[model samples]
Target: MKSILRLAAATVCAFTLLALQAVTAQQVQIEGSVNLTPFEARGITLSTLYKVDGEFAGKQGIAVPAPFTLAAPRRDGQQILAQAKPAGGGPIKIYFATDDPQKRIFSSLQIIPFTMKTDDPQKRLEIGDYFAIDLLKKLGENRTTRVNLRRQVTVGGLPAAEVVGNFVNAEGDQLLVRLVAVAKPGSPHGIIGIAVGHPRQGRIKKVEDIYDTSASLAFDTVTFN
Candidate 1:
């Protein structure tokens, strides 16, 4: 009789787990991982990943794979003006929090440098385009990041150039990022905002149902070029 009770309990537990999984499956579908290190090069750590899954990834009649959603600021995402914080010292972890309704909010220690490249620990590479390619190659070993399917309008009001990158977090749940610069009004220099968050996908379209093209949001970054 005792054995029968234990078996019944196990079956009930399994059923609860499966029920939760079914509910979550109806929400966002988890896709492949993308490296946020490039963005991290810019000093942003991804807090969380949220993306449209299933038919949403199908995108109406357009083709696109799901895009990774990124972490939110302190608790508010889309904080374009926040400065990058360094990992004080600890481990960072990543997970999903759907209860927030707001953009993905992530909590983790600021990430330290992967290697002790400098005494400051904050400086790795300067902010600029093409700077993260090497880092991306190093980190993106089995990850397929979302990139530009086609050019769109840039902040500078010019035609969309190839603004691309991946979402990565090192030691913890930090947002790793590398973004291109957007010049202001033909100025030779401009400040670009960088942060770690998944693609917003407001009205974005996809190609071949392979991946949803998205912009990074987990960190704040600016290019010096």
Candidate 2:
């Protein structure tokens, strides 16, 4: 009888833990096209290109996404043409709304989403971990270095307080580092992969060589600490 009571207690504990997690979990929604490149979480993100521009198509409630293009026609003064539909694989739902980029929704219109792998605010990128890019300075020869980076910013898009760091270009050249900004927490490919070339020095002689150039590197994939 004692053993049976212990087993029952364990079962209750398991169910309680699961219920708590379900309530505390934070959901993250990824946006953009299925092939938005680098955005592995991409599915069928019906960009606001159509609705945002004040366009509408189809009759009443219908979501049209074919050829997976960002073409939205306008009708009357409607925004979203119709209710969104699934592209193919099931994970997210897309819809039309004018002011949603700054808002969060949790119904069917979650066009693209990924459950937040982790939410520890402190588990983020350190300062000066990324590279600065001033395409204007390197436009002529398309070559820049760790010494040329302009500024640093947090991956959250907030400006960083300092402009100090370095990275090597693909051509074995040291690059002054200025992180464009820290990458967001749930970024699948937010790490800035850089490759610099001079006229025809062979775009990045080798992948490993790029890492060899003087610089720093930090990363936070799905498994955020």
Candidate 3:
């Protein structure tokens, strides 16, 4: 009877351990610092464009090129266009926007090829997340004031992360920035989508609404090719 009781107790313990392990596996894991200073110090810039294509086709007349397709919303009574630029030796960076400074909203897509030394999915995600933040900083041309959101998300059926924050541009104009980083297991590249805007009120609800619509559209509509 003693041996039988011990076996039953062990069985319950084993099941409990398995349940805990399953829960942990389901949680999103972020493997790197969320700070932006280190990345900024690297002096990465997306300013120069090696290629420019004015032809925008499909919904709202703006479509991003291969590896992924992003359909960004049009604003400010202007025709939206997708622009392409080289990211040094990395994959080309493609973006969509109008030149209306008053509207102050744009979205961009970038694909970064993975190196053998950092090929793990988690590692790729970490790098992708930082890259997304860097894109936001450069696009806004602002210094980050505060980070409001940093959480796990899914984009295009792939594991991803979203970072939203407040920034101040050179002229002291407040801005809102949102970025999503996505990585597919076993794939050789990670993708990042960035959205930037200038908020009139800067309220939390306003920020959420703008990001939920604009930033969400930038990443949620992604189609992998």
Residue 67, candidate 1: Cα error in Å is 31
Instruction: Write candidate 2's Cα lDDT for 89-168 as tens digits.
Output: 21223322223333211101211111112233332232213112322223123433234334333432432323333334
Cα deviation at 169, candidate 1, in Å, is 3.7
Per-residue error for 195 in candidate 2, Å, reads 9.8
How far residue 168's Cα lies from its native spot in candidate 2, in Å, is 4.9
CA shift of 144, model 2, Å: 16
C-alpha RMSD of each candidate structure in angstroms: 20.7, 20.1, 18.8
Error of 1 at 194 (Å): 3.4
RMSD of 1: 20.7
Number of colliding residue pairs in each model = 40, 22, 0
Q: Which runs in model 2 stand beyond 4 Å of their true positions? A: 1-116, 126-163, 167-172, 180-225
* Model 3 TM: 0.52
Per-residue alpha-carbon lDDT of model 1 for 1-225, expressed as tens digits? 334334323311221100001112233323323344334543555433323234433543322221122333222233211112111210111222323344243221111112111222112122212222332333333264444322333432332122344433432221333333333233322222222333232322222211211233232221211
In angstroms, the error of model 1 at 214 is: 13
Q: Considering every candidate listed, which one attains the maximal TM-score?
A: 3
Q: Which has the better TM-score: candidate 2, or candidate 3? A: 3
What is the full ranking by TM-score, best candidate first? 3, 1, 2
Instruction: Give the residue spans of candidate 1 off by over 4 A.
Output: 1-81, 84-152, 156-160, 164-168, 171-180, 198-225
